[model samples]
Target: MASSPNIFGKAQADVLAETGTALLQIKNSRRLTLEDMARVLGRTDDMVAKYIAGEAEMGFVAFRRASEAWPELTEKLNGGAE
Candidate 1:
């Protein structure tokens, strides 16, 4: 049997893309590598990359850590982060 379709579909993809962009911007602003972001979130570098690539969902704890890591970017992103 096939897996059920994602309920949100396109909307979900849009959110992921926006999230990836925001994270990328924040990382660039901090001059941080994927490893740095992983360290900040207590995750692995590949996990950070997956989140950035829109292949993983960002957990609240990770979001909080990122916000703490770069408050300015987080605020900017909240204001239509694209």
Candidate 2:
């Protein structure tokens, strides 16, 4: 049987957790609901919620757009090094 992919490992997991926390914080600070974020990203609320919950992986394009649009997000959440 083929082994399943390890979704969460060391580095990636840490980044995902940090990103999720940051997204949540930003959402709370802006009084934006998951639906709001979904609208902004042109995605479904369920997808945004999944990303915030760390249940879904964010693609590089989406991540880059978000980081560019909300620099504070990466700074506050990802340690501001990127």
Candidate 3:
């Protein structure tokens, strides 16, 4: 069987990469290593690295879980929502 078309364009991929970079910065600012983040998200260190490198898309649940692990980023992530 043939593969499906690419729904996400280069621009979108770029944006995701940028977001991943930003998230990586946030994690760093918190003094958390990739292994620490992996433990928090119940993922492997490689998976965390991939997510931060924008090689993989982080689902909403993982994002939310990450925010929970670092409560400070939650407000900023959700636009100050409660």
Candidate 4:
């Protein structure tokens, strides 16, 4: 059977939703700010804000830096307790 385009789009949206929520939660739990997250990703505050808002998708390098800086973020992104 051929997959519909909506299926792929929904999957991507789900990933973005999960990632954005995780980023927000982790930032709050660690008492971090947008500047802090941006520093980790080597991005601007607005860029990190976009990531947390689910307005932008974070690339692999950003994920790597975020995970390195916060092990909790890694677990959250991996769906917990990996």
Query: Which predicted model would earn the best TM-score?
Result: 4
Worst 10 residues of 3 by lDDT: 3-12
Worst 10 residues of 1 by lDDT: 2-11
Clashing pairs in 1: none
Tell me each candidate's TM-score. 0.76, 0.74, 0.66, 0.81
Please list the Cα RMSD from the true structure of every candidate, rounded to 1 decimal place: 3.5, 3.9, 5.2, 3.8
- Candidate order by decreasing TM-score: 4, 1, 2, 3
Our tally of clashes for model 1 stands at: 0
Model 3 bad stretches (over 4 Å): 1-10, 71-82
lDDT of 2 by residue, 1-82 (tens): 9544544444666667777888888888788888878777767899888888887888877777667757688688646643
Q: How big is the positional error of residue 24 in model 4, measured in Å on the Cα after superposition?
A: 0.4
| Superposed Cα deviation of residue 75, candidate 3 (Å) | 6.6
Tens digit per residue, CA lDDT, model 3, 1-82: 9543343444656645765776677777888888888888888889889887878877788878887777755454344532
Candidate 2 ranges with C-alpha deviation above 4 Å: 1-10, 80-82
Stretches of candidate 1 off by over 4 Å are: 1-10, 80-82
The window of 10 residues in a row where model 4 has the poorest summed lDDT is: 2-11
At residue 76, candidate 4 shows an lDDT of 83
Candidate 3 residue-wise lDDT at 41: 81
- Reference-based lDDT, each prediction: 0.78, 0.75, 0.72, 0.83
- In model 4, the runs with Cα more than 4 Å from the true position are 1-10
Across 1-82, the per-residue lDDT of candidate 4 in tens digits comes to 9652443446766777778899999888889999988998999999999888888888889888988888888688767952
Global local distance difference test of model 4 = 0.83
Which is the winner by lDDT between candidate 1 and candidate 4?
Answer: 4
